[model samples]
Target: MTTTVAEELRRRELERYILEMEWEEQIRTRQAEKHFKLVEDVFRQHLGEAERMTIRQLITGAAANGRCEAMVYSFPARCCTDGGRAIEKNLPHWQKTLQGNAKELYHVFTETAKPQRYGLRAAVVDFAEGFPAEIGFFVTWEPLFFRSDESIY
Candidate 1:
């Protein structure tokens, strides 16, 4: 089947949480610890107990459950896709746009009273042996935040 720009993206990846930092900071680095802490902090410090039920309801909503908003928020790298390539190369502008309207998204994944449990990561994989190539990122379903865990990466 011919894949659309969106479908081609599927070949790329998906996920929520995983340690994504420099190799030197891999298994036994402070960065790994930081990643773990970020995840924990989301569950502990963020998950608003008072609004929990409401947020859960929103997540359960038909639209929220399957909406594409998460994609726009989590993978700013979507620019790498055919449709988004231009945007990716023009990152400064993209960041500017993100800094503007995407602040809410940033909050969900980066900061706020409680941010979404997600961050960017890169992996250096050899597409062809002896070739140095890196691919990074994982989209995750942060345990019951305001939204249901129906996330795609």
Candidate 2:
């Protein structure tokens, strides 16, 4: 089989696209791992040893009866996945839920990037109806660039 010049060029372009996608995925994976560690550290400070242990169990426990909802938000970038933008748009609903649910706590998993600059922030909350009865949970990640005056970080 003979390969034409056009076909060879097309093949190279496809290969390049695939490589770029893989690289991007790797970057996201590293970011997520960093975020997880940050979350653990922040939670350790806020909760007692026993409480932290319990929370850990709940977070990692597969037996817990609940649904996990995850969201990722990115801003200051013209291009983002639909999933990322959807999470950003739903902030109001999540905020309202957080306000109403007395038992719920938004544990910030991680915040990355420069202060007053482009960055990523993430949080998770487990909603439990009663003892060990976690009904559902929500996780959110937002990547954004902030103005100097903004203080949400």
Candidate 3:
């Protein structure tokens, strides 16, 4: 049987396409493995120590930048009860949607930062497919100026 040049080209093209797909799948598998490994490491770490280190870093970075507020932490929106809708909308009860480390961080903020006049704010920081993808917790401090009722001469 005689093979035409067009047939040879088609065969080569199909083989190339298959190789490219295999390469892409390998890359994706490697990325997934790395992600899972990192997640495992996070889960094995000390929670309180991690929280304290994060808080320290946030404070130090904010002071160095001469800023009163900084994003202290972020997490995937899937961890939230409403997938971060409450945070995106700035609702009062957004904290109730927090889960896992995000919730623990909020409690730490209330117990430690709040009493020290630091305000905590949660907001949706990223979106995917028109939905919240990640939520960020910001620690803020701004002095309150009280207006006096007395008239000035």
- Which 10 residues in a row give candidate 2 its minimum summed lDDT? 72-81
Q: Who wins the lDDT comparison?
A: 3
Q: 88-132, model 1: which lDDT tens digit per residue? A: 344543333333323333455455323443443222222334332
RMSD of each: 19.7, 13.7, 19.8
C-alpha local distance difference test of each model: 0.35, 0.39, 0.68
- How many clashes show up per model? 7, 0, 0
Better of 1 and 3 by TM-score: 3
Better of 2 and 3 by TM-score: 3
Note the residue pairs that clash in candidate 3.
none
- Regions more than 4 Å wrong, model 3: 1-51, 143-153
| TM-scores for candidates 1 onward, in order | 0.26, 0.39, 0.59
Write one digit per residue (lDDT tens) for candidate 3, span 71-143: 8688999999999999999898998999998897677667655765668888889999999998888777662
Pitting candidate 1 against candidate 2, the one with the higher lDDT is 2
lDDT of prediction 3:
0.68
lDDT of 2: 0.39
